[model samples]
Target chain A: MSAPLLSVKDLRVVFSVGGTLSRLRGHVTAIEGVAGVSFDIAKGETFALVGESGSGKTTLARTLNGLQKVASGSIHFDGKDATSMGRAEMKELRRRAPMMFQDPVGSLSPRLDVRALLAEPFRIHGMSDRDLDAEVRRLLTLVGLPVDFASRYPHQLSGGQARRVGVARAVALDPQLIIADEPTAGLDVSVQGEVLNLLNDLRDRLGLSMLIITHNLHVVRQIADRTAVMYLGRFVEMGETEAIFRSPAHPYTAALLSANPEPDPDRVHDRIKLPPEVPSVMARPSGCEFHTRCPFAQDLCRRNAPPLRVNGGHQLTCHFPMNTPAQAGLEQAQ
Target chain B: MSSIRGSRGAEMTMTTDQNTPAPALDIDALSVSFATDGGTLHALKDVSFSVPKGRITGIVGESGCGKSTLINAILGLLADNGEVTGGAIRLGESADITKLTPRQMRDLRGLQISTVFQDPMGALNPVLSVGKQMRDIQYRSNLSKREKDARSVEMLRQVRIPDPEKRLTQYPHEFSGGMKQRVAIAMALMMRPQLLIADEPTTALDATLEVATIELLKELQQEIGCAVLFISHHLGVIAELCDDMIVMYAGEVVEQGSVRQIFRNPSHPYTRALLDCDPARLHERVKHLPTIPGTLPDLRNRPKGCVFQARCALAKPECGQPVTSVEVTPGHIARCIRTNEVTA
Candidate 1:
């Protein structure tokens, strides 16, 4: 009911390819990394961006965090426009919305101990006047790490422990939003459960909104309130997580869901095996970006780009969506 | 060789069936220790399993579970400081791999036992063409150049790589991740090895490619009739691709059974915990996922009792004593003192 915590509208990030020679010759090529994406995250809501590598999920996250410059459109965070924010405002925005990178150990300074890593955020945000020691201990305890871990360096901690430390640093500023990229990656199954539980617990306890970018659909299914399936830097499907899993509107969403290997051996897995190659962003397919890989693709799909069709909260960009009889019936009525 | 005979005799007595053909690879009471700076780290202890002929046996475990060590021991490529402390790795009919010299092991590696690693780029030569690399893998064979080339093409075709002849000329960089992995698999099966060791071969690929690769592996294994040892940390992949699975915990095989049996009813506390931890197994959204409580025991000074005792929820004071495996059912076993209580 309240205003959304983060609102991104028509966000686009582009990068110029080739060297200065191509620019001098007036033949420079540009690639759209995050091509005109839009989404909103309500307060305390967990939103997930699911796609394979180079699908611009990470780029979009970076753009929101102000790590990457947006070519167009706006990022409104906590009732403030982040795109046009000056240095001080951007610095404040960074404090309120911290980014947790993929590699836990690599992201943390190897030289710094857990205490310093936790304190660094407060110091950067000009909040070092408070008791840093107590704050460090509090963060460690919050993330379910032992208080003794404060003295340990990044290399000393295991993968799961390092990830917890990363979590502690992300929440150090008491941020309203936490953008985690592949939060459970490279962890063992049991450890992954621990990390997920911690994140879930933190979300509930702190009342924080989250934007999770991951290729692991299992994570999305478990944690996300809502999800968006990105293909070639744009969302092919966006809707309630349960609805998306139950009956995917876009063919790409169905393919992704079926492709995830379920742990049960008894369940027959009829995987939608797409053609191996992912089309380059520079040379995206005409019309539907996923038409090349979509098993149900037809002549009409390749001729024109599909509009974002909305039915209730579910949205899809496909010429012929799958597994939504109600939406099909509605379209027929229209 | 004579010293390993007693263990082989013991293994034979344990086998329930006499008519079944000899397993492609039999690892009997195998123990591997690495001389680390801290101490002699026992990476694998009393690890016993059989890769049955023409069947897929998966080894599933997290990091430090010694799956890699077992593979290295089988391939005779353990690090210089690592040693086979005890027991035997009997490959096919005659050889106890631990006793084999470097020369003998090299001769047996490619022809008798081939391996497909996780990263295809690392497995393949970046400078050389795919055709050249595939052809060169058969250097031990007496086949002619043209014959090897033809065999390479056939192998690629079997893996369903489009336009095998044209794709062969392209280098590793030219192929996509899935295609490169396919190429790696084709090359590994080129010799029709008695046993194939795939160490997390599909972990690097996307979800679609991962399932596709799993299906291809299943089809190819059936076609080649070679025993496969599929090692992965993913429970889902192991469940889907393997016929039999060995669940390792802290360098010890905690449970071993048919995939169907294990998935349906896991006997060991560790196995049950691991299965519960998998997000794919959980249908409903829960507030907190079940997690194994503690970290793996230090390898240098492993606990006297069960390796997973500290983390196991069903552990008892009696579990402080060293435990041997208990047969839950025919062909299903768990190495835990509380197996009876838990299974009951």
Candidate 2:
């Protein structure tokens, strides 16, 4: 529909996992941050990147805005190839797709007030003479903050308030795609709702495409139209949010959903107790990266990595996919 | 389990009824204050609740709601400027925790009451191996060095730490966040404390790890027969693991009841709002979540009447008067003047 806002093909990112000394000695180990990932964000749709820590969600997010160098892949933004884009084209790509961080306090300058913070984005884009002060107040108002907040410094605001300011700054330039990484984390339940709703409202009002990277499934259920579950730098499951939650195609997705403690006490969950914590990225398992932790891992799963297979609207990489009556019961139980 | 429970409360084994056991911890009109540079800040005021023997009692509140302060006060680990102005913390029949000397409190800490903090990395020493840290906690006991090492391994096994022997030798940095938390839990339970206070223990964990950790905590508590005081802001976690729940706001108890009672029929406006605010509660995705309208009142300002009145949508003129808890059900209580009007 009207060309996807952003498209990626075999996106792979790597990092040297040691200090300068090791790099000089030519013995530095290479760690895959985002390994052979591919996805598309349709225009005006909210896409979610769901994963636990070290799942490459943040790495992929950084690559979207050209902040992280791509080891190999194509990032086509607004029908433009970002990977091969020249200096001017890359600048335009960044101007159209901004990134929002999880920690508002760390992202924001302590000395700057809300007005300056919001106006900085405009100034960076060379829109210095566009009544920047008035625009700052409008951004603050758009995110449901008091107009008077423009006068207050970041430190003076509460955690929720500061995060709202972060959202305001991200949307200051009216970017088509906003990459919000763990936006509602560390906020109170009510404040989380407030922030989520604010993002939803901004999307609807501005017709903005959102790429939210978060571990919180509840947020994905609420705001995201499509979801991609990442594990050890690769997508394990990707599909519509409703389909993924209703009947997860992959074992990791099933385990993750079942593990989410629903607020309802009466709704009994069939918790799939994962054997051990997610394996460190330094020593990612052979074959399927998630085979070590997958409950349905078999000899085939351990020997050869499953290709990303698409069925109906869902796409997953799993050898022994859980699509039987037993799997349906897990979904129904929730 | 029965043997430990019986031995701990031999003299005070009086049960309220055949169904209910004596509370492991009872607080009566407890008040705690911090001497700030500006003024004396009342962190907790007239707060009263009980952790029934062998049950999980959750203290649910947002930041600055005095949940951490209450836990610190109970553990005798409050900040230097903080003081318990008035109240009685009766642990057992004759043990008044508030009156205990510093040395007595230190002796009672790991032996009687232990705590699991929020950040596992901060709670553990990064330099020392897990075995060394765990064994250090058991050193004061009469057990020999060999016995202490065995006990550390056993506790690690109980928490389901994979390859317990190998894990014990690894430093904190080597363990994943979830594994570190498990080790922290194992260390907290190494002494077999009668009361375990966990302050947002799973807040830093992933959702999957968090559920597993909570399940482990529940299983261990049942096996050890210790009263647990779980402090958290996540309603989902509290709803799942807690037997009884306490809702606090701005240093005051706004609601207290059984988990079923609270979830099924929250009588307080604040609790109802909190539940409504949950993304899980919304069957269909909506544009804006129903917010509580305003932030919690500043601790320094200290609202005169109901602490939640400032942000509460159901606040009435009568809320300006002093508010005390009124029973909404058999054991459920809500500290709102208009408790009868509010519905879950």
Candidate 3:
């Protein structure tokens, strides 16, 4: 088998707050109970990480990007261990690790013009200053922005325009991988569509591999080749987008699908009303993590942890795979 | 909550007031323009729609489409810079909402029509107890203090809030996002306004909570028999709760018709793109999810041709006509000049 472009195993990150609290007794458990979590991203393929707020999706993303320090885990990139790599080595990786943030305006420097912003990445990687201007113009044209806008500052551009500039900046170093975090959160629907199209074009034209972390399912449906569904801190299901949406295997996966409002109004959206909120990580339930909220909670669920099993190239972490909506309903009723 | 009747559980009772002759809210070709630092920006253009007595009419558009501006104009509460250049919005029969004096508008606002904003957390005061705020709004009502208390609790019950009597004393932070919206609705109904203008009230909530809130609103409308002007960006939400829908873009009504008519036969390119935008829009998988191409044009230098022509793939030379709109059906209409070219 061909080697994967990126791979991670048993990744875990924890932050300990310090102050007037006791020296020995740790304060504030931000994230815990994360078991062996693993995934891979192939060349020119898009992998998606989906979960609601505070489900550890952001933490995992940061860890993968080498922004956040990890406690115990192994991250292999291009067949090398990146966990303990030096700053210079990581900087070499960072040159290729272009990231697009959620807020485009906030991400770009307010005082810098678009051309300077786009050229910074190229200059940082020791590329020639003479070629920078030509490269900036090419990147701007590729992103579908007019050359005149290069002279304008970030504040002068519209929200959509600013996002395009941010994309150009990320791809400035000619990176093989792009990690986008909620790329379209606050933008208008039309603008969001435009930005999505730009990203799609970039992926196809550049042959870029992408790892998109988002809470919006619509985004996943549009760009993802495969999806990983996260609950608390672990992936409950990982499969092709069509399989995940059409026949979600895990009970938690099925419940989440049931809970999301169907975009079509003619069809009454089925909702599995989970109690008010998900529990905190400090008090995560034992055995099967989702058994507490599972409608089919039994003695076995509370006594044993479920292992992720493979079925027709899909991985599901549920004792009983609930595929169809009717089957999920029956499990709940039982 | 005591001010309005919500016909939530009365499914058959909703039709009772729709057949009535009197118009509850009348907005005629209303246009609101803003004087920004840039230039004279026409936010709303010759927009016209009316809500029948006890019927729900939904207005849907994304940001900058002036959905909220239209609702605020009905209350005669435009920002310091905004002005209505043309048209009239009359509420409760003869009261021309645009020309009402400050004092008269005050009397007309809560008593005749109330607005439910999307952000319940921001709309509610965190410092004040819910009960005190309730009493403050209803102090001028005919009901006495004790009677108001009874009515307030009764209104809470009507909306299906658990432990209404206890909850009234707690602050807004004590409730969840959905519950906070219900409280906001209860406050809007305190005057029993003839028209309840809900501006993306459910957008702030999750799917389960959002669906329930709409169900609650529908039941409340049935009981009160009051018209509701529901505004949202989600067509799905509008279709579930509204009898009629008005599609807006830039500053004009691109399409208007019964929800069923508009959903099944969207006559405008903008409307079709909107329906196809949702990834989960259909039970069956789409070969490719359709998306509107370009961002909406700047309101300052508005497009001379069809406002949506810049992004529309079906643009023909005839779509360049700027001064005409076509009626596509018995009660449905679109502003696009290519009415015959595009099929619903």
Candidate 4:
């Protein structure tokens, strides 16, 4: 794949908890036992990150965008180490690799007009050409927004319009990589599809490599070229889209797939039901992070953490992979 | 279990029966309008559908689609400023919901109908214990305090809450988001009302927890004989839970049909657009989601035509006439001009 557009290796993040409480003086180490996580995204391949909240999906996404300082990791963009970039280099990278947030309005400056908002990214990147107005007009039209909307303020735009402005700003610097975090959250169903389709079209036509962090499996199944399933800060499964969906390699991935809404109504004959909630992030399980609520957990499975291994052209860190019904302790999962 | 598809109406209560005498809840020409600060907002227009005796009827729609209003209208508790301007919801021939007086509607609620609100914390009282909140609904019944407590505990356990005794003693603030939702469902089911209205029950929850909650609801509905009006923005959950379905858009019933008919052969343009955007279909290159691509028209000054016409893809000039729902199938109906044109 000639040096993939983006590559992340051995990423780790931790936060000290209970430090404020003088009596309970200790560190609640988060994201431990997650070692040497590595993945490569092809130039135009859209990679999706799916996991329960607190699975460090957001942690990994933030690390890539340089929003959250890395504890220990190396993020390489276009064969250059993003983690080691200087201030000027980082600023350049920031413009060329802008990020989109979940809440469209939350990320936008409420006071700024749509035209000014789209222009802000260009100005930040020091693109002060006389023809910038024409460029902004092209971007607005590209995102299916009317030109008359440019003078209107952010508050004047609808949720979808705000989202279009956000997209325009992200692509303003002509970034090769776009990292979107739950981009369609809280949008009306009608608007949600439009945004998803736009992202898909952008990836294929613009050749933009995107890292999508979301809990919606349907989103993952739709736009992703490759899928990586995270659990408790570590990726439990990673593989091609078709393979991952056809035969999930990790128990966590299987549970997640089973929980997702399948188009076929009769598909819900047999599948494991999710537990009521996820465990606290501070104190993760001793072994096999997903073993806590796993239907087939045993003493051997709980005693030791499974090594992240590759099988059938995929990376998985589960003792029990979602192979066949009988293999994953499901006579019917077949 | 697949046999239930054939005996759906009889084996389970809510699945519509070809021979059954009465639908669990029959709503006819129901319209809800609000006299808001903006103006008189036409929220729901000419909505009609029936829930089978013991199955789930998912009323799926986006925000401001009058989904909540329809639920409230059925519960006989339309908001202070809102009124059912037209139509009637009948629980057999005896109850005429549109004509019911406040006292009669009050009597009808909790016994004939119950509701589970989306915000567990907001819906629940902070000062009240879980047991007290549950018993409040069942208190008027002949059941004693101990009986109510036992039933409450059983209901909690049925919803898969661990250690019901400890949970009942704790207040709403003490419970987690998923647990609070469970307690709320437990309280609503405690009444054993003939009909249950769940308004966006899992929108505030994580996608995983939301799935488990839907399963619990399906299980509870099966065990109890009440029909469920499961309202949510999630088309996936609606497909999983509903036997018959109502697809609402901008305060109007855009499409109403069986789950199979709606999924495999959606008639209305809005309904077709919704299913097309579904994440399940996202695997391929979707050039355009073909969304009903405009915010719902301001309800106050709603144009005197089809509300979805502003955003609809197959709309014609004549669609400007007042939209009327007609029989699209033996049991399916839709209120759109291009119902036949939408190949979805």
Candidate 5:
């Protein structure tokens, strides 16, 4: 395969809690939001990150976009060293890879009309010398919105319309990569289908690589080529979307898949109900982070951290990985 | 007016079965309108459904589909601008909720019908401890403070909260999101009301926590034997947790039937489209998903005949005239003129 469009290696992000007073009193503590996670997105491919809130999926996405400070590890985009980029290089990177936030209406400036919002991206990157009006029309047409909608403000547009405007803005600079966080949230089922179709169409048309961060498994299955399951700032499982859904190797991944309620009354809902409490990042669990919630957890899981085991394209971190008898037998023999 | 009365009288006679008890809540041809600047916006137009005794009935609809309005009308908490323009909401034996006095409605609220809202934090008081709030809700009872505390502890235990005795003294902030929702459910059921209305109670929770909450709710509802009016936009949750389901569109109940019947075979164009729109139901990866083309009609100037005519693919010229609901099967109805074609 050709070189990946974007590559992240052992990336980590740490946040320090308490104010300066606490620091002076030697009471400061650090929490690893994204703890040494790595992944790669090929050109025109979509990669998804799925987890509950505070699992550092958003933090990892932000770190990739250079919005959050990376505590360690390296990042490479299009064969360029993103971690060591200077101000000019970083600004160029931002233009080449724009972000789409979660809240559709909240992300866009309420005061700006659709035309102004779409044109703001070009102006920010100092490309205002072009025909801004024609550019705005082109964006509106690209996202399948009417040209008349360009005059409407953020509040005037519906949720799905506002999301279209957001998409138009994200692709305004013709970025090689787009980072979308919960792209289909807060939308009705039909409207969600519209947005997903638009995104899929744009990816194919523009040859864009997308890093989608969402907890919606249906969205992941629909658009993503690869998926990673995050738990307590680490990837418990990563594989092809089809393989992950068909036979999840990690217990956490299985639990998450089974938890999704299917819109079918006949199907037996054999759900693995995890405990409600999510451990705080500040107070990390002793060994396997998911041991407390894993239904198949044993004494070995609590005392020793499992190493990442790779089988073909699939990789998982668990002592007794499901659906692979060879690995389970090897662990048992040990 | 006489025609409206005639239909309501017919419905009453049909539901008056001596063998079976009256439904916990029966809404007959209910209509609600809010006075806005443009005009009187009919939020609910001749809506009718019944929450059967000790059965779970789920209402599924998108925003602006009158789910919230229906809940408010049932609880007598509609805004000042809102009014029940037509029909009656009968609770139990003899109370027509539209005619109830404010004091009587207040008396009926927590004692006969209880509510569990979407946001647990908002439903619960931040200043008071869980135990204090639970005890305070029982002010209408003659039980002593000690008895109330004991009942609160038992309710918490029933909801599977660990260490119910000590957890009761903690503030709302101390509990996790799922735990807070569990506490909210406990408080809503503490009065042992005949009816429990859960408005997207598990929507704010994670997928794992959501399943857990649904199971807990199912267990508790069976134990308490209370009629449940579960309102949510999520088709999956409605299918998983409800015995019967109502599909609302443009402030009208477009379809309703048993959960099995509706899921197995949806008759209405809108209901079929909605069920098809669910990504989970699609087994194969497709380039584009099926979508309803047009937006909802304006409530103030509602379209002439069918509310979903503009967006429906199967709509015809005959749909321009007023369309009566068709009974697809026993207790299964669809408000669409082409139900025969769709079902066939």
Candidate 6:
């Protein structure tokens, strides 16, 4: 088999947080944003990092696109050591790996019209203005936005239009891989569908690898080929999308799948409710971060962190991994 | 909490009559408009829906579809420039809410009806502790400090906020997003109001947290026996938690029916389109999602006939005429001229 396009090993990102007052109190806390995480993404594949807020999914995406600093561990991107890349190499890497932001309203330049926003990438890459206009129009059409909308400012566009502009900007440089952070986050379902379709189309046509970071399971089901479920800066389950949805080996993954609300009223779901709140990342648990909320957490789970183990093409980090009752029932029926 | 409601017994009786089976809320051709500088924006156009006693009624629409305007009109909380041009909001058999003065409405607010907004921080005070805010809501009540504190703690526990006593002493900032929503839910239910208006209460939380919050809302609604008017843009949420649903488009209700009937046999083209667009409903992979072709018609330039005709796929030339709502099934109504031909 061909090597993966991106490989990350034992990645860690730590930050020191404190002010002068905290210094007087002798308390400077370190926040481990991404703690010893590892993953690989093959070319022309859609890999999703699914997690809620404070789960460090965003941090991991930022690291992938060179926007975030890596405190430790190694990253091999397109056969290059990303962590040790110098200034020129970093710039080149950035050109090949573009990022789509979560908030299109904030990401798109308010002062500039859509034409300029989309054309700026080409200008930055030293393309002449003659080619820029054509490229801008092409990108806009690619994302299904009208050519006339190219003259509209960011504020003038609707939520769905602004998101299309975000996608248009991300793909302007014709990058190999796109990192979209909650691309359809605040959009309505119809609009979200449009964006997802655009993403799926672009991935297939351009033969681009994508790293989609979101908390939405529906999006994961619709677009992702493989997925990694993250919780508090660590991957709890990683495998094929269908397999994870069918039989989530980790308790957190099962709980998350159950929590997803289906649109069909006939298919009434009984969700597995987690205990009150996800604990603060600053004071993470001593062993497995999820042990405090895991329904099947045992003493061994609370005392020692479980290592990721491979089983049936699934990588799960749970001491006693088992399929949920729903999955088990389906298996029994089969 | 009981004492607080007891103190406002007169106001409660005034709003809710002793009629045996009166719906919690009823609106008859309610119309709301805002006097903008350009022209009068018809925020809500002859909207009508009822919240049955002890049942959950959901209103689903896009952001500018006037779902919020309908909720605002119910609470008499529209903006200064906005006005109710026509129609009546009947609260049970006793009160026509449109006729109530601001003072009377204020008196009836927490006693008879309360709201839980999407952003809990906007509803809560950052400087005040959770307990302080709860006490502030009951300032008009005759309860003592100790009783108020105990009641607040009890309400917190009722929402399943772990360490309820410790949580009350903390400020809103100390609570997580999910926890803040729980606190907000707890505060809304503290008054034991007959009607609970939850406007996108779980939109800000994650999917997992959203499920938990909705479960809590359902549990609390059943326990309090309050008629809940849940307004959300998420169809999945409406399907899961709502008993009945109202589909809105351009300030008008395009469809209203039992949740089961609407999902299983939708008659409106818009509702059918919405159901088709849902990612969860798709099992096969398609390159492009089937999109409803056109954008929502501007409220100011709303079409003369069917508001949804501009974007509807099955629209005909006769759609330009006034569309009449037809009862496709028992208790299932759709505001479309071709309801006979269309099927889910």
Top candidate on DockQ is: 2
- Give the residue spans of candidate 5 off by over 4 A: A19-28, A324-334, B1-18, B142-146
Ranking by lDDT: 5, 1, 2, 6, 3, 4
What's the DockQ for every one of the candidates? 0.55, 0.68, 0.27, 0.36, 0.51, 0.62
Indicate the residue-level lDDT of B344 in model 2.
32
Is candidate 1 or 3 superior in TM-score?
A: 1
Total clashes in model 4, counting residue pairs 3 or more apart in sequence or in different chains: 9
Please, what are the lDDT tens digits per residue for candidate 6 over residues A1-334? 5988889999999877887787789774678899888888899999999988889999988887778899999999999999999988887787788889988788998999998998887777766555777888899889998899978998998899999999888888878889999999888888888888889999999999999998888888889999999998988899998888777788788788778777778774655668867887778887777999988788998899887798765898888887646446322110
- Summarize candidate 5's per-residue lDDT along A109-165 as a digit string, tens digits: 999999899999999899999999999999999999999999999998889999999
TM-score of 4: 0.84
Instruction: Compose the digit string of candidate 3's lDDT tens values, residues B37-139.
Output: 9999999987876787888988977767888788778888889899999887877677567887889888877778888998999988999998877777786
TM-scores, chain B, all models? 0.95, 0.92, 0.91, 0.88, 0.95, 0.92
B114-134 per-residue lDDT for model 4 (tens digits): 888888888899999988988
Instruction: Give Cα-based local distance difference scores for all models.
Output: 0.87, 0.85, 0.77, 0.77, 0.88, 0.84
Model 5 lDDT tens row, B1-344: 00111112344323234566678888888999999999999999988888888899999988778999999999999999999999889887866888999999999999889999999899999999999999999999899999999999999999999999999799999988888999999999998889999999987787888899999999999999999999987888988999988899888888877888888889999999989898988765788898878888999988888999999999899999987777677667788989989887
lDDT of 3: 0.77
Q: Model 1's CAPRI class?
A: medium
Model 2, which residues run further than 4 Å from truth? A18-28, A86-89, A332-334, B1-22
**lDDT tens digits, residue span A1-334, model 2:** 4789899999999987888787789763799999899889998999999988889999899888888899998989988889888877777777789898889788899999888898998888888989987898788788888898888998888889999999988888878999999999888988888888888988999999999989888899899999999998999999999888888878899988888887777877877778766787788788887888887788887889898799776799998788898678767243
Model 2: reference contacts kept, as a fraction: 0.78
- Scored by lDDT, the top model is 5
Q: Which stretches of candidate 6 lie over 4 Å from their true place?
A: A19-28, A123-130, A268-270, A324-327, A330-334, B1-20
Best by TM-score: 5
- lDDT tens digits, residues A85-198, model 1? 999999989889999999988999999999999999999888899999999999999999999999999999999999999999999988999999999888998899899989
**For residue A264, what is the lDDT in candidate 2?**
79
